[model samples]
Target: MTPQLLIFDVNETLLDLSPMKEGITKLLGNPNAYEDWFSILIQMAMVETLTDKYSDFGEIGAAALTMTSQKHSKSISEEDLKLTLHLIKELKPHPEVKEALEKLKSKGFRLVALTNGGRETLEQQMNYSGLESLFDGFYSVESVRKFKPHPDAYHHVLKKEKTSPEESMLVAAHAWDIAGAQQLGMQTAFIKRPGKFPYPKGKKPPLICKDFTELYMKLTVDA
Candidate 1:
């Protein structure tokens, strides 16, 4: 079935985080600290949800970077931390993203972005990446003070759009985000970005594309 609404996960799913990875690695003085910091950031987001506590995604990211520095026995100044994280606002969409999204929108898909980032951060990202006009709606987990993989985060978009889970499809690079939407009965598409994979034990995505170009082909020319 063709979905009426296409909900996108902003970070690695649409916008490339490689720029941030480069900045973070340089800041931490370790080539691999970026991955460590990101893993901790995601883990801590879930930790906030499970504990019924909320923090802005930006704050969590800063804290996660701190934790990574501590683990590596490196001292990071606050100024450098903020500067490194600021790269997120300057990220570019993956090379083929803009063109593919344009094609999808031409097909009458109701495109939207759902991110774990805070509203301000989401705005900065979209605006800087030149994708703000592409989406019909922009959503952040901050609206409900919950993170993705939490049912409420996915439900927020559904309720706002008056669309059923089955009538929507979530496109993401993260296995956990796909799993969250899957549990709610939404159609799922996994954009297999480099260094990203679906969970072995989770529900499989109905569509898996190498990039948004392939995704556009599958959802349109090949549908």
Candidate 2:
């Protein structure tokens, strides 16, 4: 089926977060802190899903921060935690992200954001990127309190978009996100950005391109 809609993974896909790696290392302790924090965040998010609990993304963020800090015998002020979350909302988009989304939107596919961020943070990030106006709607895992890799997160997006998995495309830079979406029967497109991954969880994306510009060419969008 021709795709009528495209749902984007928000974090590493649209935003460039290489800076955060440094920020967290200095602030938290380990250079690999982002990965550690992110892993725990996902674990907690999934825990919420497994136990039928739902919390805002911000709450999950705070809990994850507290847990990680406590485990490492480090300290993080509440203000610093707020600042870190704010950084996410204020992140800059990837250099090519806006142009890519513009090209995709002009081709008549409805664009939506599917993220693990809270709705408010997602909105702020979108507006900061100046790509907010291009998106038709935003959906987040906050709706289901589950992080990526959980089928419910992807399923929630599919249901809200009112399209079958086959009729929609999931475009992401994270292989795990791609995997989860694919498991929900959604067609996927991978944008192979540096530091991103592409190994599939179940099958794989039907198309993988170096960037959205190449993706546009494959879709044959008239310039």
Candidate 3:
């Protein structure tokens, strides 16, 4: 069934992270450093949720960068770290993102963003990408003090929107996010961005498209 509400994941899904990747590559002199750092950042965020500790996503990112730098026998000054983190707010949407979002909106789906980033950061990201007006609402996991892949985050969005799990579909590039939403009985669409793959052990999403354009087609024409 087609969903009444379409929940989207930001960061690497809708917004491209290549700019941030370039910054990390310049800083660490390794083209792969950005992927390593991002992986660690997600791990650390889940650590906080599991340990019952709370830290803003930005703080966790900084800490992860520090740890990653230390692991590579490099030291990142506070000023440099802060500057790099600021690049997140300046991310641009993927090439097809705006058009696909417009297509979805024109079809009358209620679009919302549910991210692990803080409210202010998400706001900046949406505005910078010029997609802020496309969404009906923006939500952050900060409200529940938990990150994505946690059941609470998905439940909170469902409750706030007053939409049942079956009536909503989550669109994300990450396997973990899709798995979490699946556990809550929500439909899911996975966008296969470059180098990203779904977890082998998780339930496969019903819709797996190459990009936002393909996803839009699958949802609108094929569904």
- In the range 1-223, model 3's lDDT, one tens digit per residue, is 8999999999999999999999988877788789889999999999999999889999999988888788777777888889998999999999999999999999989999999999999999999999999999999999999998999999999999999999999999999899999999999999999998889899889999999999888888954
* lDDT minimum window of 10 residues, candidate 2: 214-223
lDDT per residue (tens digit) for residues 113-222 in model 1:
99999999999999999998999999999999999999999999999999999999999999999999999999999999988999999887999999999888888864
Q: Candidate 2: lDDT of 213?
A: 76
The residue-by-residue lDDT of candidate 2 on 1-223, one tens digit each, is 6688888888878888766656666778887677777678767876887787778867887787778778777898988877775667667887877887888888888999998888888888888878889999999887876777789888887888788989998889878788888888888999998766688435857879888778777765443
lDDT of each: 0.93, 0.80, 0.93
User: Which 10-residue window in model 1 sums to the lowest lDDT?
Assistant: 214-223
Number of clashes recorded per candidate: 0, 0, 0
Stretches of candidate 2 exceeding 4 Å from the true structure: 221-223
